[model samples]
Target: MVDENQLRQWGTKVVDIEKQALENLYQYIDSSEFAQACQLILQCTGKVIVMGMGKSGHIGNKISATLASTGTPAFFVHPGEASHGDLGVLSENDIVLAISNSGEASEILTLIPVIKRMGLPLISVTGKPESSMAKLAQLHLCIEVPEEACPLGLAPTSSTTATLVMGDALAVALLQARGFTQDDFALSHPGGSLGRKLLLKVSDVMHKGDELPSVKHDICITEALYEISKKGLGMTAVVDSNNTLVGIFTDGDLRRVIDADVNLRTTSIADVMTQGCVTITENILAAEALKVMDTKSINGLVVINEQQQPVGALNMLDMVKAGVI
Candidate 1:
C-alpha cells in the first residue's frame, strides 16, 4: 500500500511528464505536412479509412468515430486483418490514414503493397518521418514527441496522445471546411444529450389547444384564476377584441393583487394583467426558450406563430416532462 504523500508525488510527476511530452508534440505540429494531408482528405469523395496495429488500432477506432461525428465519413480497419482479406473493404476512392509510433509497424508495413496496388491516397502519421511507412505515403503528418510519459519509455503513451490530437485536428479541419452545423451534429447524435439540446423545439413540448390557460380580456380575474387552475400552467394569457393576445397574468401578479385587495370577482383580467409579456415562437428551440425564461425570471411563456398569435403555452414543468430542462 502506498502512503498518500507517495501517491500525490507520483501523480504530480506523471502530470509533468505528460505535459512535457505534449509540449514537444507542438513542434511536430508546426513542421509536419498536416495541411497537405487535410487537403487530400477534403478532396476525397469516398470515406476515410484509418488503419493501425495494436495500441494504434484502439486510437484509430476513436479517431474514426470523431471524424464521422464531426463531418467527415470515416471508419477503422485493422491493418493485420487487411493483409488477409479485409483490404477489399477499402477502395481506390478512399483515403487511408495509417498510424504507428515507430513508423515501421510490421502489420501496417504489410498493407503498403496492397494499398499501392489499389492506388489509394495514403497519409501516414508517425514519430519518425524518415521511417519506411512515412516515406511510402504521399503525405506524412508527423506526431513526434521527445519522450513517452511512461517511465520505461517503451509503452506508447505520449506518442499516442499526439496521434489522437493530430486525428482531432484533421477532423475539425474537415468539419469546418464542410460548413457542418449544430443541426447536422444533432442528426448524427439523436440519442444523446447533444441531440436533445439541438433538436428539442418549443412546439415539441409546449401545451397546445385547450391545454393553454387563456382568457378573454373582458373576463374577471376570478375566471382567469379558474382557467390557470384547470390548465395547471401557473399563468394565463389575456386576449382582446379580435382574440389577439394582449397581456398575461401569473401567480406572482396574484400575490401582488391580494395585497392591494383587488377584487378578483369584479376586476377585469386586463386591469391586473402584465402587459408586454414575453412570448416565443413555435419554431424556436426549447433550449432557447429556456434561456429566455431564465433571462426574464419567468417560469411560463405563450408560444406564438409567425403572425404573432398565441398557438400554445408551457411552463418549466412541461420542459421537465419533455427532458428539455
Candidate 2:
C-alpha cells in the first residue's frame, strides 16, 4: 500500500524539518533563562527531579539520563506518579525540571503548589512562555519550533526534537562548567568500550610469567623463531643473563635477516635483534599502550616492572580482544 518513492520523499522532508528545528535552538540555549537554569542545577545540593506527562515524560527520562551520565545527578518522575506517592522522592534540597510543550499540562500544574511548599527551585521547558506552567516556575526555557514535521500537523515532530536538543544543550553546558572528564564518564559506563579503553591496564590483559615469549640474547635466530611460534606473539623478548629485557626480535627482524641472506640456524639473535625497543609499564592504561604502538607503528610491546625487568607481554590482538584498540 506504500509507494517507495513517496515514502523516501516523506522521510527526507521530515529530516529537513527537524534539522531546521534543531538549528533554531541556538538562540534559546544562549538566552539568559537557560543560564539561570544551569546555575540552579549546578548549585543544587540534591538531585534534579524531571517531571512530565506522556511524550514529554519520555523526553524527560532521556534528559535525566543524559544529565546523570554527564556529571549531573538527576532522575525522572512522572507527574501522574508524583501525585500518588512518587513525590516522596523529592526533598528540600532537590530542584525540579518540568517539561510540557504547551506549558499547561494539568498534572504538572497541580504539582506546582506542592513543589513550592517543599521550597524546591522549579525550572520549566515549554513552547508557550505565557502558559501557567512557565509563568509559575522560577526559571523558564522556551522550545518553540516553527512547524511540525507531521503532514497532519497533529503529531509532535519538530517540537519534541527541539525539546530534546535543548535538554542536550543544558546537559553539555553543565558538563563544561563542572569540567567533567572522560575518566569521570567512564566511571558510570564501565561496561562500554570507552570504559575498557580508559580503565583497563596493561597487567590486566597481558601474557605473564611462563606465557611470555622470551629467549636469551645469545640464542640463534632459529631458536628465537621457535619461541615466537610457541608463544604466538609474532615476536620474542631477548633477555640478558639476569632475565632483564635487553632487546627484542620480531617477524620484521626475521624478514631483514632473510633479505641479508643470514642463515637463521647460525646467526645469534643479538646480532639481528632491535635494541632498546619500545616498552610499557604494567600500571599504564591499555589505551596508552595503544597510543605508543600507533606512534611507533608496531604491533606488540614488552611490559616492564619498576626495576626494568620484563614481567609481561601483549600485542595488538590482546588490545583488540579487550576492546581497547
Candidate 3:
C-alpha cells in the first residue's frame, strides 16, 4: 500500500522544485534572445508555426494557444506530422519556433533542411544551447533547469515548467508590443465569460421596445408604478409629450415619497421623479454601464439614443445575468 506520508512528501518535493524553476525563469526573460524572439514574431507578416515532439510538443500546443489568444497568430504543428505532409503549412515568410529539451530531436533535426531551404526564420527553444538544433537556428532560447523534479530524472518536470513560463513571457511581450487591448482579446475569446463581460453592449442586454418601463411625465405616480411593475426593471422613465426623457422614477423614490405622505393617486410622476437621471448610450459596453451605475450609486440606468430619448432600460439584475457584474 502507498504510504500517505511518502505521497505527501513526493507531492511537496515536486512542487517546490517546479517553483524554483519558475523563479529562475526571470533570468531567461532578461536575456537578449528573449527580446529578439518577440521582435521576430512582431515583425513577421506570416503566422508563427510552432513545432516540437513528445512532452515538448504538449507544451508547444499550449504556447501556440496562448500566443493566438493574446493577439499573436500562431499554431502548433507536430514535427512527426510535418514529415507526413503537414509541412505544407509552412511558408517562407513565417517564423518557426522549435521546442526540444535536448535540442536534437530526430524529427525536428530532419526538418531543419526544409525550413532553411524555404528561407523561414528559425527560433530554437531548448535546454542545451550547444546542441546542433540551437547552432543551426537563427536564435536560441535556453529553458535549462538545474534538475528535473522527477526522482528518476527521466520525466519532464521542472524543464517543462520553465519552458511554459518562457512561452508566456514571449506571448505577453508580443501582446504589449502589438498594443493589444482587452477588447481585442475578447474578440478572440467570445465564448468565455470574460469575453462576454468585455464585449457585451448595453443594447445587447437591455430591455427595449415594449419591455422598457416608461410613462408620460404628467401621469400619476400610481400609473407609473404600473409601468415599472409591468416592465420589471424596478424603475420607469418619465417622458414628455414629445417622447423625450424628462426624468426617472424608481422604487427608492417611491419609498421616500410614501415616507413624506405624498398622495400617489394625485401626484404627477414629474413631481417625484428624478430629473437628469444617470443615462448611457446604447452602444456602450455593459461593463462600462456597470461602472456608471456603481459610481452614481444607482441600481438601474436609462439607455438613450442620439436624441436623448429613452430607448432601453437595464438594472443590476440584467448586468448580473449577462455576466457583466
Candidate 4:
C-alpha cells in the first residue's frame, strides 16, 4: 500500500523543484540573447516552425499553440518527420525554433545541415550551451536548471519547466511588441467562452420588441406582477404613457408589498417601483453589462435608447443562456 504522507511529500518536492526552475529562468530572460530571439521572431515574415523530439515535442506543441493564438503564427513539426520530406513545409521567409533539453537530440542534429543549406534562421533552446545543436544554430536560448525533480534523475522535470517558461517569455514579448489586443485574441478563439465574453454584445442577448417585459407606470401592482411572470425574467420595466422608462418592479418589490400589506389590486406600480434602476445601452459588451449588474447588486437591466425609452430587457438567466455570465 502507498503511504499517503510519503506521496504528499514527494508531490510537494516536485512542485518546489519546478518552482525553483522557473525562478532560475528570470536571469536568462533578462539577457541580450532573449531580446535578440524576440527581435528575430518579430522580424520574420512567415510562420514560426517549432521542432522537438520526445517529451520536448509535447511542450513544443503547446508553445507553438500559444504563439499562434497570441499573434505569432507558429506550428510544431517533429524533428524526425522533417527529414522524411516534412521539411517541405519550410519557406525562405519562415524561422525555425528548435527545442531539445540536452541540445544534442540526434534527430534534430541530423537536420541541422539541411536547415543551414536552406539558409533559414535557426534558434535553438536547450539546457547545454556547448552542445552541437546549440553551437550550430544562429542563436541559442539557454534554459539551464539546477537538477531534475525526478528522484531517479532520469525523467525530464526541472529542465522541461524552464523550457516551457522560456517559450512563454518569448511569446509574450512578441505579443506586446506587436500590440496584440483582446479583440484580436477573441478573433482567434471565437468558439470558446472567452470569445463570447469579449465579442458578444448586449443586443445579441437582450429581449426586445414583444419579448421584452414591460408595464405602464400607472398600471396596478397585480398587472406588473403578471407581466413579470409572463416574461419569465423575474422583473418588469415600468414605462410612462409615451413608452419612456420610469422605474422597475421585481420579485423583491412584490415581497416588500406583501410585508407592508399594500393592496396589489389598487397600488400603482409607480408608487412601489425602483426608480433610477440600472440600465444599459444595446451596443455595450455583454461582459460590461455583467459588470454593471454585479456592481449594482442587481440581477436584471433595462436597455434604453437616447430618449430613455425601454428598447430591451435582460436578466442573469439571459446572460447564462448567452454564456456571458
Q: Once superposed on the true structure, which residue ranges of model 2 sit more than 4 Å away at CA?
A: 1-9, 255-267
Per-model TM values vs. the true structure: 0.87, 0.88, 0.90, 0.87
Model 1 residue 79 lDDT? 86
Best-to-worst order by lDDT is: 3, 4, 2, 1
Best by TM-score: 3
Error of 4 at 120 (Å): 2.2
- For each candidate, the alpha-carbon lDDT, in order, equals 0.88, 0.93, 0.94, 0.93
Q: Model 4, residue 122: displacement in angstroms?
A: 0.9
Error of 4 at 202 (Å): 1.4
RMSD of each candidate relative to the true structure: 2.6, 2.6, 2.4, 2.7
Model 3, span 70-136: residue lDDT tens: 9999999999999999999998789999999999999999999999999999999999999999999
What ranges in model 4 sit over 4 Å off? Answer: 1-27, 191-193
Candidate 3 or 4, higher TM-score?
3
Residues 23-127 of candidate 4: C-alpha lDDT, one tens digit per residue: 888888999999999999999999999999999999999999999999999999998899899999999899999999999999999988888998899999999
Candidate that beats the other on TM-score, 2 or 4, i.e. the better one: 2
Model 4 misses residue 35 by how many Å?
1.2
